[model samples]
Target: MPLHKVVYLANNTKLYLWKITEDLEELYNEVKLKDSSISRLDGMKSESHKKGFLAVRKLLQHIDYNDFDLYYDVHGKPNLKPQACGIKEMHISISHSHGFSAIALSDKNIGIDIEILKEKILKIAPKFMNLSHLDNLTEEEKIKKATVIWGIKESIFKIKNETGISFPNHIFEEDFNFEDKKAFAKLKFNNKLEDFKVQFDSFEDYMFVCAFQN
Candidate 1:
């Protein structure tokens, strides 16, 4: 199967998922042809990182790689400069787990995260789990709820394009049901509140969530 595919999630946002098929030599040569910078990176990391980078580079090509320069902020967020189209500035967030690499591209700030649903999620729940999330579920239900909540918080962090925000405590999630596959969040930061929409779905064995602020 082909490794690269694109989905239009919203008017301003697109999602790309890449599955690795080529060997390292082929991938290196392919990336080098598009951008010299990628050719310098070590491809021996994990398979996920290699696939993710290829997918991101392919997306960059679609947007005219030469006109815009790619650089990372101090916080590690990717930013793109003004392009020939005169469109709004573009922001991107990339997340990968297992064998899948997911990227979100949009004119506005965006964040996306994916995690395999596992029993281990229960063990880490307390660190970021809010009382409201716990109150709505039993022991067995908590694991899945916790996974979704974690994704929501991480997505918010990406949307804010900053760190140091509390996960489940300072940032609250409400008006969401896991079974219904949707959730809403109220993120409190710097004495102000912003609203977010979260959507969850199953892809292979992972639970994926995409969130953004308009």
Candidate 2:
């Protein structure tokens, strides 16, 4: 029930963030799930994952939607059931990390990611990011910046949602200072090049990133 924050993004997109502070029973009782979601929830072995799943449903209710209004496609991207009034098509993206879960909704395509900053990212930075982007920074800064970069790629991938897209090979973030909290990225794959505008900010020890195709 702790709705952490809401951010309004470009193109009428809205990002809802929830900090998981409820126990499994509390969240399960509060969230009304469709049969598919119930099955998905039952299949989640980790209590942490279950909590994240329920928290996202809570976010939907906060905006006057519910599990019945949500569905996933073959690509695993979330979608909103069109309203009877013939409103604009709504696109949704969902993400969760250790203690947080987030959903971004928009009339335009958007991707969002929330990641807890951790030192583990440092060891694998080269696998998913440009190592030179971390140079001339303290260890702590490296973790934060690297995690943000990883989140950037994740957000873009969610936007693209294409198979065979490699994090380090397909998506690349344009170098930007950590203080700015925003950057740009390019995706090159299948003989196509596309640009994306990235926006990110940190809350507590986690980073929330959003991407809009440009």
**Best TM-score goes to which candidate?**
2
Query: What lDDT does model 1 reach?
Result: 0.70
Residues 1-214 of candidate 2: C-alpha lDDT, one tens digit per residue = 5689988776578899999999999989998999999999999999999999999999988888898889888999888889811468888899988799999988778999999989999999978988999989999999999988998899999988999999989998999998998899999999999999888998999999998898
Candidate 1 clashes between residue pairs 3 or more apart in a chain or in different chains: none
Clashes of each: 0, 0
Model 1 spans > 4 angstroms off: 1-5, 33-40, 43-51, 62-69, 84-86, 131-142
Q: Taking the tens digit of each residue's C-alpha lDDT, what string does model 1 give over 36-125?
A: 345535534766666556645654565556313565678877666566326677777778776666777787678899787788888887
The numbered model that scores best in lDDT is 2
What Cα-based lDDT does every candidate model obtain? 0.70, 0.90
Return the lDDT, model 1, position 127.
78
RMSD of each: 3.5, 1.3
Cα distance off (Å), candidate 2, residue 163:
1.0
